[model samples]
Target: MIITDTHTHLYSNEFDEDRNEMIQRAIDAGVSRFFIPAIDSAYTHSMYDLEKAYPNTIFLMMGLHPTHVKDNYLEELQHVETELSKRKFYAIGEIGIDLYWDKTHLPEQQDSFRKQIQLAKQYKLPIVIHCREAFDEIFEILEEEKSPDLFGIFHCFTGNYEQALQAISYNMKLGIGGVVTFKNGKIDQFLNQIDLKHIVLETDSPYLAPIPLRGKRNESSYILNVVDKLSEIYNLSNEEIASITTENSKVVFGI
Candidate 1:
């Protein structure tokens, strides 16, 4: 069975020591495809290096993360445009409003999110959103940018059923990650109500590790844990979860 990790920062410094080993572990665990999202210009080199090292397994996206939006955001968006002009990327993402860390940059974050959505439309590419404590704000921009061209995944989705339906209306698939494995992760309560076609698996590795490994650094190999939990929640087999979610990921990433 082939599992697709639709949103992983495999190129992040968190895996600097044994990145190859970590990737191999995921491969052994049936995770054969990884979609890497860009945070900013700073991570471009490492992301490129990762793609070079695993040409067959890793795909990359370019954009400024919502948390990275700052006073110099215009320059950063320019950098994103420059990078997009140079080569192809799977999507324009890991971008959206993140109010959990700091709300001071709300205006800039909203602007950046809208601009990146425009970029995604320009390139006919999908997006991977990183929303936290700002669903209302994110939805506002998505509402304005809503179109057949503006479509992607709501990465690490942890919202209520209403929000899930709203995101789906905007042509987004909910990205399910390690959180679902948590005993108290609320998404589990209603995830079964959402069809498998609208769901995709992810680890959000080096962060948000699932139960048993909760609070520990996560890796793509641990995606199996998420898949197992999903099986229990949906009352489906692991293979079925893997198959359906992988297909759902392909629809988003166009892989």
Candidate 2:
């Protein structure tokens, strides 16, 4: 019953007080694998230290998040490239256009997204995307960069059925999480029609907590809530959902 949380921020300051306890809670809940996404150079040390603390359970990814993509983005990308040269990273991640917060950086966000995709291909690593309010914009770039080697997860995917099929066309798997448990989170409506192979579980924790805990801080242990919802949606047992999604994660992340 090993489960994988393909995206989470255990390194986040929000968890500073009970990080270890929270991780233990998740482990107890059958979440053995936790893939950590990087925000920027600032969190690099914390991410490495977290991996060191839970070497086997915790995995690390490096990228400049779109919301963080500002005037100094070039220097940030340099840090990502330099880190890749220094050691192994599971992916170049949490990268893509974010028009929700501020559209002013849309152009720079697109440029950064493309450059990072190139970096991912160069390193033969998967990418974890963070897209918000820019589906058309993000898909536009993905269309241009589509290739046999360009592949990754559409993290925290909250798009339509057509978008799901479209993302798969580009070799990406949908990262399902807390949203699936929300009563109005529409993906649950058509999810059963989609293949489980195209899906993976995430919490995006300290964020989108599943209902029963929505609007509250989320943790990987709560990932079980997501699994339960998915089980109901796909008409399978929790173990069946967990095993398949964990396997799907391995296929995407190569872990």
For candidate 1, what's the RMSD?
A: 0.7
TM-score of the candidate numbered 2? 0.99
Score candidate 2 by lDDT.
0.94
Q: In model 2, which runs have C-alpha deviations exceeding 4 angstroms?
A: none
lDDT values, one for every candidate: 0.93, 0.94
Model 2, total clashes = 0
True lDDT of residue 49, candidate 2: 98
lDDT of 1 by residue, 162-244 (tens): 99999999999999999998878899999989988999999999899998999888999999999999999889999999999
Error of 2 at 11 (Å): 0.7
Q: Write the per-residue lDDT of candidate 2 for residues 145-187, one digit (tens) a residue.
A: 9999999999999998999899889999999999998888899
lDDT of 1 at 159: 97
Q: For model 2, give the 10-residue run with minimal summed lDDT.
A: 98-107
- The C-alpha stretches of model 1 lying farther than 4 A from their native spots are none
